[model samples]
Target: MLPSKTSVTDRSWRAGTAPGALPLLGHVPALWRRPLEFLASLPAHGDLVEVRLGPARAYLAAHPELVRHVLLNPRLFDKGGVFDKARQLLGNSLSVSRGEEHRFQRRLIQPAFHPTRIAAYTTAVAADTRTVTDAWRAGETRDIGDAMHSLLMRVAARTLFSTGLDEATVEEARQCLRTVSHGIYKRTVAPLGIMEKLPTPANRAYDHANARLRQIVADMIAVRRRSDEDHGDLLSTLLRAEHPETGQKLDDGQLLDQVVTFLVAGSETTASTLAFVFHLMGRLPEVEKRVHAEVDAALGGRTPVHEDLPALPYIRNVITETLRLYPPSWMAMRVAAEDVELGGRKVPAGTMILYSPYALHHNPDLFPDPEIFDADRWAGERAAQVPRGALLPFGAGSHKCIGDVLALTETALIVATVAARWRLRPEPGSALRPEPKATLEPGPLPMVLERR
Candidate 1:
């Protein structure tokens, strides 16, 4: 049996099942190799399509309504066993915590991402961005994706622990995060496979990456703990942050998890989106021109600050549209705690559910010519018409990404800063594709840097 719904349960068999599944692996190959096409194909199968991960049956909530349902009803579709791989690295951080625990942690960490904090963090954002892109030479090729990742890593380090975020720490964090991002998705799809236990090269690297990532966070916490002087950064906020009712502060382990949560959650999605923004601008010169004009008008030869964000509407729209086209956090998982009905069909208890912002954003009915990179779709009037859960670049509802504002602020500032300096032209003879790693990353984006 393929575990393709036909062999699992009658409810799964009755639902439209995604085809081309293997006996044991089921949809893992499809998901691993051609994730975008695989996800996009599910809507055609049915609004709620059944697929498999290893031997376990799962449902793909292809419609935004079902996705909204899953996202909103946290208790019903919580981050339980469905996200074991992610949980391994995330470690019950706010990103993965459920119930009252999640709420309590969110209360502690929310202040660090407050609008005021976001504005304060822009200095680090602008500086770190320039540091990464400054070394670019005219007519030279560079992996913008790698650069953005490194940039975001540095930005996070500076913002998280301004006191001791040296080059070594930033470099280690960047490398370890990339390793985890590269390996996490693979582990998720092959949950039941014995490859996880074997001492294979991939397994070794994955294990090493996980340990290194935890250590990276631990080192950051140690550095921050040693510095009694207030650094006025995210680490300081988190250190002092107390619960509203109980007035409780996070313990050492809790604080460590929170730090890892920010680094893991904030870095890749924002970085990849920024990288894609540059790549898209490369492909769409007209869009690039408007961004340039906007950046020029707002930040004439000066670095973009927090206040400059309001003046850079087109830049923001470009980022938003890029997000719509390639939301890095494309697929999100939820496991049904109890039996539930979804899309007028029965979804059995403990059934793992998946939703993709990539699929929904590409739904033509929602946004016509969904594949095209049209920033105007999110422009003033048109932006209003988008459904509430339709644009889930950072997800929606209670478990929505808390760093959404911070990430958006970083994107807008980086867009303004980079657009002001150079035009990144796509490399010749390169086959561009989104690799579904930690996020839907445009892997190895070799772009030609042209000085403005």
Candidate 2:
């Protein structure tokens, strides 16, 4: 029988096991020290494992169905505390809003992320990807992570912002974003508002970087606002977009926040996906060969147009498999607005629930041999074997990633383009590990690029 509320002490959670607690500190250090292993070790206790982070009580829901229920029923469980922190960066953007407000923002931003709009950027994506791939020397070794970061930021500048920004400006923006996002994640785990208020090196660096990023967005918006013509970029679209109901538009502050949101979201997640896909392709020869074969057959020696994506089944599978293993947003947090029952446990109002895509994606039952990195697992015939809501790289329900289709299209095109020109060989002695901060960063992916 499940333990009752009365039976379990308020100080400690009863549903799942803990690694025992430190006198007053709880599991903060342990969680920070080994987040991945700590989570991966949770199934021994129960599907809904409990962990203490300082004074706050957070539960990790490892069951795919429970995760689905919580995410799908956003009305019951809203994006809370951590999401509030996200608002510190994203402001009143679509990611931080809830209920009617969320619906409205989503509706307003929906058009920019539509498949048709994203497809229009394929030529730009291909052109930019080719530019990067062509620059890679055949025998020289390069850091794949850095290469993708540069390439992806360029793609984001052109496609998302429509800024036509140069490499130096994009690099500056990327550095600022890296600092701000890293600070945000650090603050999230260990609350640091007071430190931020005081002018320490870490705090000052974060503040300065954040300010610069905001200013860049402001300048971009100002230039667009001054322009007499529409450029069909996201910044222009957002600047001119009218809310259907009130016909009111986003103000300067809100506009800047949305721009930051797009830059942070569109750039980092896609770059991480590409990194993981490339890393996996280097590790798995059969997978890369199959992907190359599929891409070649689909394109038939012709360059891939936006329309060819629908027929590229294997490319989609490769992306899906990579996402399964290395989800960019490894974990997500939400707080219950009211009392709710999830996975037969009565969760109280305001209870913090953590849903980890990393954990769910690695569940052995949901994914047989989950760590194997097999693309065929996501193929049409086999994908149905996995339960609905099991694969949550883009999240689920209303709050699912708005850029899911765009991410797929960009990744497929870039991966295929690179494969068409170069083959990446992982360095024999190099060690690559998922260093997740904001987005998963597998830093210094030293690999040799051989021209195909």
Candidate 3:
């Protein structure tokens, strides 16, 4: 029976009593099958629902208020547990650390992604986009996912590592990234500490990919150290950076970790976003017309400049709306550090908490006709009705994406530049579907780019 408010004890309140799990594998099958559907179904049962893993219970909170509390109160919670496993691939970079250590690392790494600095990289982004698009013959078939990936790969190569590793090396890193991303989810769901011991096919790929990633990042770091000349890439910045208070630079290991963090975090998310943008434009004609009009008016037959970014509201909305529907980091997880009370319920320590941005964005109460692609929602009085944290595609509070501005600027410029020059339509009979991994992307989005 469901207990009344005062009758429930703290432990029961926190636990919230969940449905029984399937035998040994527990909810792993459901989680693997359709994670977003699994998350969306939780709210119908209760505000908080627990699902048993092999042994431990993973708690999910559905309400926005609870999400705000968890995000804002970093003291009460931290990005450890789940992130620790990720740091195996990312190192001790900003994505995993906490408190003063996290603060210092973010400080040293922040300058490279700053607005002025990101603007400085626009020329490279434009050049890369032009280079890739120029080869397209009129009415030729293309896989947009592959195209976007190539463009993002070039951007990361130019803007991320200071050593400027050649294209072949960066391609190797991209391969490793795909393997590691798949590995992280598989390893995390496997029984703790058993991932490395297992001889499964997935585990074998994980091991090989992780080694390749580490070796490439390590080689780039060594080259950076030996160089006397300065290049303004993120790797160079980290190599030369000194902690403001301690006046100490990162050692070789730490530097490699940071590089790994940048590659894994920066590359896929940007590529996924551009793929979504193209998919949306294909479906929404009015949005495409307005966006193209805005770009034409702003550029006036000239190439996009960094200064024009602020004046492009419709472009910003298109990017924001894409993120809302298809957030890069779809699910965020945290383990309870201590017995705590949330939303008038007492949750015990060691419970894994899950937040689903995909579910929240689709909440009909917050966003009417939530599934529709509408950019005007953000333009005028319509945006005011939405709650503060409700529109988070880059997330909210302290753990929000550090590279959001860079992502948006790259999206606007790349999309506008390409859209102005070509008309993209889905290949006949191809249905755009969401292939959810670390981010939402249209799998092998085959489209024809016709010369405008």
Candidate 4:
């Protein structure tokens, strides 16, 4: 039973545990089937709603204030939950590292995202966008999800390696990523992890894909080591980077971890966001016309590079709203390092904590008519009114995503480039569903490409 609505506002209100728990599975069924809806429904119960994950009970921070406490205080609630599960794939990369070690990991990787380096990477982004557009026909319908993933994988490979490996290997790596991503979420929810070990098709695919990707990367690393020339790409930066405090370069294992992290993360997240952006543009014709108009005035069919970002504020805001509505990195989880208090509630040590940017962004109290897509809100005084910590597509505090600038730049450029030549019209026959995997992917989005 839930507490009264008035009691929920009271300072002493304890969060209600979510109803409909099966004996062994708990809330896993709800999460497995309808995670986005499940996350969005919690705020009505309380700011700190308790829910079960398999056998373990986790607290979902339903309010932005509670979320800020968890994200800002990294020491008190360090990275865990899904990130800890990520360690099986990415070793000690910044994704899962904590405390001093996490700080050191950031030091090693931060240099690649410097202003000049990012500008150079934008050249690759522009070139890759053309590669995708050049192949599209005027009236062809596209599987936008797969197309965006393919385009982003190419962009990620070029920016990360600058064509160090053969095209075949890059394509193979991209396919492997799809398999690995499919298996990670199932592993995260299953308690005790015995089911994952069984010879299931999904399990086999994940294991094989993981091994093949590692081998491909190891081979690339060895080949790059044999050469002395600097490629000026992300791989070269990491290969040459020395720790600020220790003056030590990362070992091969550490490099592999970081490379895999960037390859998967760099491509997966932005691709999903762009896919959503195009789908939205298709659904909202008025929005599509404005974006196309902006692109023409800004670029005149020329490819959009990183420096052109300022000229395209509307495209950026479209991406921003897309992120708000369908944040790919939907669920951010942490474990309480010790006993702590959040939102006037006592939280015990070792509690697994969860926060959803998707939920907070959709809160009607925070943003009125939250379901509607509005880019103009981010343009004028309305944008200024957005509460701090309310928009967390890239997260916050010390552990915020390092490639945020690059992600935004790439998304805006792709949208601009696509709009310059064509307008995406969502295929009306298909009913799109949000498949909650490693990212919140728009499953099977077939869009007809209408040449503007």
Candidate 5:
């Protein structure tokens, strides 16, 4: 029987197991088979369920309220696990930093994402979107996933660093990022130090990619410093920014770290989201029709501009519903800094805490007909009814994505621009599957582009 709310609140700390736990392996096998499905099933076991990752005991917060409490109190639950592994590529940037360092970095980085700053990026976003879509040939089968990644990488390169990168450098950086991203999930879950050090093919590729990425960032920084000119981009902002309290600026190494973090964090999430949005549009004819109509009325066959966003409410809803269904940052890990009570249970210091936005967004109680793709749910009063911490595509609390405004603007403009031109239809025998990586990506999405 399920534990009653009052009963759960009154009880002391206890561990609950999922259905298919085995000796030593525990629930890892089940997790590997179908991560999203397995995580969604966990709430039935308990709000604070014990998840064993190959003898490492971790607690999964299966309830939204519990997840919120953990996120809001960063002092108690700090970034660790995968985030530590991320530092191998990202260094001590805002995404992985904690406490005072995190606060300082956030203050330095906040201005780049300010409303006025993000609005200025829309012209570049629109131009990049056109560059990709204009090249699409009608009736050709395209890998939507690859297309989105390529397009977003260019958009990120131009918007983040201005015109610092050439086409060859952008392509090289994209390849390097993908190579390093492939092994991040395995490194995070297993984290076997000796195994990672072994001369495996994957390890070799990771090493090569890491070196290339660092070199790319270093080159960009060097060229910018030599020019000594402000181009009014994110890199320029970072170069000029000073810590509010210390008046200290980021050194060259710290600048490289922030650049790497921005590229990895910003590019993949937005690309994955746009890919999923296109995939969904191909499947749901009704949604696609509405999107087309909205875009046509809003853009009038002209290119999308920053001012056009407010007129395309339906396009925004489509992005919101897609995020609810396929959140790019699917799972997060944190370590407890001190003993604390969570869901009325005592959690010891040094415990690993796991939370999945995939699980929380699919809760039937929070979202009725959760599996249905209904963009209208976000329209009018319905969106206001969504519970706090239930729809965290960019996460929540202090660590919430600083580039959220920029990402949303990019997404809205891209969706409007594409839907205004082409209708994407799934190719025959194509199956859409979720590949749970560091980011949750739509695997092997092939579609035929029909010009509107």
Candidate 6:
């Protein structure tokens, strides 16, 4: 028998259960079939709906206000669930750290992403973007997804560490990162303890990739230590950072975690977002024209600089609209630290809570004609009217993405630099679909590079 829907005033703290749950698997089959659609439909069931993934029961927050409440009260709902799975690969990095440790790590890493510091990186961002786009011929066919991933990886290595990796190493790192990301996703959803320990092909591959990632980080750390010189980059900042109160520095293991966190976190999301933006442009020619015009007018054929960012409002809007439609970090999970009342319902301690930017961005009530791509919605007063917590592509509160400034800067600069010179034309019959891995990525965006 399926669980019944409960009323808000029941006061029993019993959440309305989703329909079509099987005997033991619960809603796992439905979620596995269409994860995004299944999550989006939960609000119709109740404000706070019960979801059973295997034997574990979790609450899905469907209302924007409830999501806001949960995000704001991080102490009551600390990072857990999927993040705990993420820690197996990420170690105790900022993304997985809790309480005082997370705060201290944030402080140590905060200076690297400051506006002034991010501004200094803009020159390198533009130069790196140009190097890739300049190589594209007028009639060349390319996989834009691969191009964006490669471009962002190079930019990250250069801007974050002031190091240039050979093409082979970059390719190897990309593959290894993808493996680790896929492994984390698999473990989060399936969570078979015994399966992870067995020498299955997937398990063996994950272990190998993880070891390679660690070795790469160790090598980078060694080189930084040997140089012992400040390159005025993020690596230099992290190496020199000290806690204000304790005056203690991060040990090698902690430093490795932070470095790997920045590289993996920064590269994947930015690349996925850029790839989506290019795909959207290919589908919507009118939007592409506006973006190209804005870039041309603002930049005048020169590479983008810090000053050009503000002048290119249309380009920024295109990026914003793209994020609204396809947020890279689509969903986040937190565990209740204590039994807490939410939406007039008591959620017991040890319960997991999930909030999806993907669902929130697609809510028809919050955004009119939610499925359409409209950059105009973000222009002028329309942008301000978007409710708080309604548009969280970068997330909210203390755990919000630390790389927002850098990510936005890189996107705008890349868009302007490329749009000024070439138009990406999606090849006919190209199968573009959202493959939800660690990030919401568009798979293999094949397109022709048409010179403007």
For TM-score, the strongest prediction is 5
Better of 2 and 3 by lDDT: 2
Q: Which candidate is the best by lDDT?
A: 5
Candidate 5 runs further than 4 Å off: 1-17
The models' CA-based lDDT, in order, is 0.81, 0.79, 0.75, 0.83, 0.85, 0.82
As a whole number from 0 to 100, the lDDT of residue 249 in candidate 6 is 81
Could you tell me the lDDT of residue 340 within candidate 5?
77
* Model 6, span 54-145: residue lDDT tens: 78888887666677667767899888766777787688999888888899988877877888988876668888888888888899899988
Best of the two (1, 5) by TM-score: 5
lDDT string for model 1 (1-452, tens) is: 12222222233322588999999999989987888888977877787898988898899988666677678779888887646566765677887778998888888778778999867766777877788778778999989888788788888788777657679877977888777766766676664756778998888987897788888778777777786766688888888889888999987898887787777778888888888998889988899899999888888899888988889988888888999999988887888889987766777898889999888888886788888888998877888888656788888878888888988888888888888999888888865788876678888779988999
* lDDT tens per residue, model 3, 1-452: 23333332232323353454688877777777887777656655555777776667677766665676677666666675767777665667888887777888877777767777777655577667787788889988888887888778777777776346787877777787878876776665445776567798877887898898888878777777797666766676667787777887889998878777767777788888898888788878898888889888888756676787776889888988888888777788776678887656666887677878887787776788888888888888988878656666777666778988888888888887887788888888888777777777668889888877
Model 4 lowest lDDT segment of ten: 1-10
lDDT tens string, model 5, 343-437? 76677888889999998888887789889999988999998888766888888778999989899899999888889889999998998898888
Under the 3 Å rule for N, CA and C atoms, how many clashes does model 3 have? 1
Pick the winner on lDDT between candidates 1 and 2.
1
Which residues of candidate 6, in runs, are more than 4 Å off? 1-17
- Model 1 misplaced stretches (Cα beyond 4 Å): 1-29, 52-56, 200-202, 206-209
Q: Which lDDT tens digits does candidate 2 get at residues 9-76?
A: 23232367467757667777777787776766675567788778878777887776667767877988
On lDDT, the stronger of 2 and 5 is 5
Give candidate 4 misplaced runs (Cα > 4 Å).
Answer: 1-26, 53-56
Superposition error at 335 for model 1 (Å) = 1.4
| Candidates 3 and 4, the one with greater lDDT | 4
Counted clashes in each candidate structure: 0, 0, 1, 0, 0, 0
- Using all chains and alpha carbons, the TM-scores for the candidates as numbered come to 0.90, 0.91, 0.89, 0.92, 0.94, 0.93
